[model samples]
Target: MFWSRKEKEHSSKKGEDFSEVIERIKSGDKKLRERFINDYRPFILGCVSKHMNRFIDIENCEEFSIGLMAFDEAISSYNSIKGGHFLSFAELVINRRLINHRKKEIKNSKVIPFSYFGGENEQIIENSISEKSIYLHYDRFEMREEIMIYNEKLEMFGITMNDLVKKSPKHKDSKELMVGIAKIIADNDNLYNKLISKKTLPMSDLIAFVTVNPKTVEKNRKYIIAVCLALKSDLEIIKGFIRKF
Candidate 1:
């Protein structure tokens, strides 16, 4: 999704380009800069949420503040020739800042203060680096754990990530309807049990319990089951992504 320099220049014709506005901001358009940041607050929050792997409360999140600063820094440092797309660069900066902020927090939580071991400054530096590495490793480990569990669940229904990406409803109304149907099935004990045991959507029971079109249910059976599985599991990050939709 990274925009090339040519794409950034030409996309204005489609009314989806931000390069011009970014250029204006870079040229010291203070008012537009403020408005631009305000308008893109949701994008900033989304990047932070993805890193945190949960829903965020914008009013209280320190990470969100860091994201905003990082985005502002991106606008200041961004180079169309070298940065690809402004947003892509901004997200990279935001994630890097958030990671560094997290590492500092981890370092602060050490059992003894660095000042306590006056001549052991080198040891403290080594421990900090080690902890940062472990933090990153554990973060990847947790995400992998969730993905493995989700993949296993999808396999039970004979669905792949490719299937979901390709078959997921393109229309907003259709997507909402599918999510609603999935929620219903996930909430009902009998329907959920039947789906788990059968390893397929219980269409008849779902239709009987709800007033949805049977053919629609059948058409999106895999997607419906996938959503239901997400709802039934403890995969907070997966659930967070679904909430965005």
Candidate 2:
């Protein structure tokens, strides 16, 4: 059996629009909801593991459960038309859930001692989870500041986070290719400055310089611009996010 050209074209665009998929998932599209979970599972686990400092057992782990719930919350709360990425919002929710859980655990217990360690050491460890929660606030604060800086930087380039979220390349291979294009721009001085100064994709230059399709580059123009700026700027967290998911 063979697929028709129209069928092939329909399949091609089934999941390409990330923002549309997210909105449908929020509107109770069961298939899309499943896709959302499967798609972002690794991302959610990565956030949970980094926050918890270990790989989580999704089968029966509370932290994993919390992370899933937080991700779900992020999905419901995500505004695709707004200027923010879903993963960033999800990470913030995961951190908040973990922090609140630690607070609750600490509050419900009185003189909870760990006999494995001496009394003082156990107390220190127990208190550390609570205290560490406060320090995590600083981490979130730094991310917020970075987001503000990133937003302003993107504005200078005539783009916004909403544009990135909406126009990101559909396939991983396409995204990787775009990342390479971004690297090319980041590695060169003139191209970088031209893009920065003009707030636009140097399409002719990129088409001549980078070995990629002009149509593809233009289709993912906003995302390429954002990635180029992120790679060139001090946006560590955003860079890590792009590299990770």
Candidate 3:
């Protein structure tokens, strides 16, 4: 259920008034402890169920047990004055423990295919199902065609997509750097109109005129230079073209 901000505020206020309940539990009041569990059982169970998909062999019983334990732990240790409602605080504790439990399960379990449907005798069937699932999701033929087109474009630029992805964020800050250079070129009225009118320009002309840092220019020069080179124009020729505007 979605909780409105106002409803949350009301619930929080109610939780704050439960300070006496918290004290009673902390002081070993058994009846108050049971009452707390009875009231909050559904809430705790809901939290556990939400995260149940993360665990293998998890059942209603297991979820209920984990939720109750989490509830008890929250009750025994919660400090109301720390802030927020008791339910909110308790929910956080329950969810965290449940997540920890799932993480432990993942660490200890073998990586079995999700499609594995039967016992030991169904290993071959499981492998066949897994292979089919991969092939269906990852269209191999279309992927290769796209890769070929990307590589052909990259070849004109003297770099590869692999090289770009491997570069650090500090290594010229790719997209941001290109945008800044574009802005600089657009700031000059003549060049701005030409770019707007033609919708294209030599990459080297744009970069050399706009970029301030020679070092960054040199380091990232290959990408822009490749585009200019692909247009079959020399760097000096491209620079001279930009100088006219």
Quote each prediction's TM-score. 0.47, 0.47, 0.38
Kindly list the per-residue Cα lDDT of model 1 for residues 58-109, writing each as its tens digit: 9998889999999999888775422134665576678768767866766777
TM-score of candidate 2 against the unseen true structure? 0.47
How much lDDT does each candidate structure score?
Answer: 0.73, 0.70, 0.51
Candidate 3: regions farther than 4 A off: 1-16, 53-60, 112-245
What alpha-carbon RMSD in Å does predicted model 3 have with respect to the real structure?
19.6
Supply every candidate's count of residue pairs whose N, Cα or C atoms clash at under 3 angstroms: 0, 0, 0
TM-score of 1: 0.47
Tens digit per residue, CA lDDT, model 3, 38-156: 76776776766554433334354665677788889888767543223466556656655655554454446523344322354454444433344433333343244334434443453
**Judged by TM-score relative to the true structure, which candidate is superior, 2 or 3?**
2
Instruction: Report the lDDT of model 3 for residue 17.
Output: 58
lDDT: which candidate is best? 1
Those runs of model 1 whose alpha carbons end farther than 4 Å from true positions after fitting are 1-140
